[model samples]
Target: MGISRRATAHWEGDLKTGKGQLSTPQSGLLDNTRYAFSSRFGDEKGTNPEELIAAAHAGCFTMALSAKLTEAGFPPEALDTEAQVDLSMEGGPQLSQITLKVKAKVPGIEAEKFRAIADDAKQNCPVSKALSAVPVALEAELL
Candidate 1:
């Protein structure tokens, strides 16, 4: 089993005018000083939900693509995934769109096949599952 990770956040004052600290139990880099709050959701340098979602998308897509590539007998030499989450003020706090881009280097694999595999990963990654309410677009390339 993988090791568990923990992060804690502390907030002072109200949600809009308050400040907060985000810390990780195991990493000093996530110390209280690393996070702050501002009028923007009561945070200054602290990351918000959208940033977290984009990070999740990047991680999930990379792992899913790796697994899919291995299962297809063309394990990737390297897989780079990035996600851009767009938060538009349509009606509520909604994820307007997500753009996923992946660049993969897999020996002995055709570009089209690699792109298809990445597409499948995009559709089935855990982040994708968790974000069914949002629309996700993909731009996959194999090098």
Candidate 2:
């Protein structure tokens, strides 16, 4: 069986000066949240697609890392992951890179083993697989 989720976006006006709203009906976490050109390209106080993608990648990779650790007999006590998505517009608008930073606490696990599992998780996570075309880098620390 396959699971599905949905979110909707509404935009009004042109691309440069346009305003938009995004919402996730099922979760309602984003209830018509605002996003615009300035918000995405400039440093404006609103959400952007890259930011949302980073958040989703972070969450998905963290869960995948947890599952990998558990399978390796080193269930994590805690895992903190941050995913940074880089958007470049040199040639055109493109998702250039994604960097993941992970700090994990797992008892009785050596740093080498933990790093190995984390590497595997980064390579095989659903989100990572989906974004395989983008360059992905990981900096994992066992704490």
Candidate 3:
């Protein structure tokens, strides 16, 4: 069986000054929220699209990396990944770039081999494939 996730967003007012709320149905948490162009352009206390993409990219990349490691007979003890998504306002919400950074601690793996594994993960990751139009860069470290 396949698992599913759900989230909902509600927005009000104009784009330049609107406010919104996002909630996770499974967790019953109303944690996600948004407000105006102000935050993206120049303010805090609000969420933006790039940040949300970063979250998704981070999750998807980590899962992909883990799968790759397992397949290569070197399953990671732990994998820490972060994604930074850049959005260009000039191009109207275009994904300018994505940076993926990973730190993995695995037994019996050389640093060079680990780096190669991470590169494979980055290339074959579903999120990376989906964001193929945008540039995806990776930095992997074994510790």
Winning candidate number (TM-score): 2
Tell me the whole-model lDDT of each prediction, alpha carbons only: 0.82, 0.95, 0.82
Ranked candidates, highest lDDT first: 2, 3, 1
lDDT of 3 at 63: 90
lDDT of 3 by residue, 62-115 (tens): 998888888889888999988988878784768788999888888888888888
Model 2 error, position 13 (Å): 0.6
CA-only RMSD, every prediction: 3.0, 0.7, 2.1
Cα TM-score per model: 0.81, 0.98, 0.84
What is candidate 3's CA lDDT for residue 104?
Answer: 86
Clashes of each: 6, 0, 0
Minimum summed lDDT over a 10-residue window in model 2 is located at 110-119
Residue 7's lDDT within candidate 2 is 100
What lDDT, from 0 to 1, does candidate 1 have? Answer: 0.82
Which pairs of residues collide in model 1?
36-44, 37-43, 37-44, 38-42, 38-43, 38-44
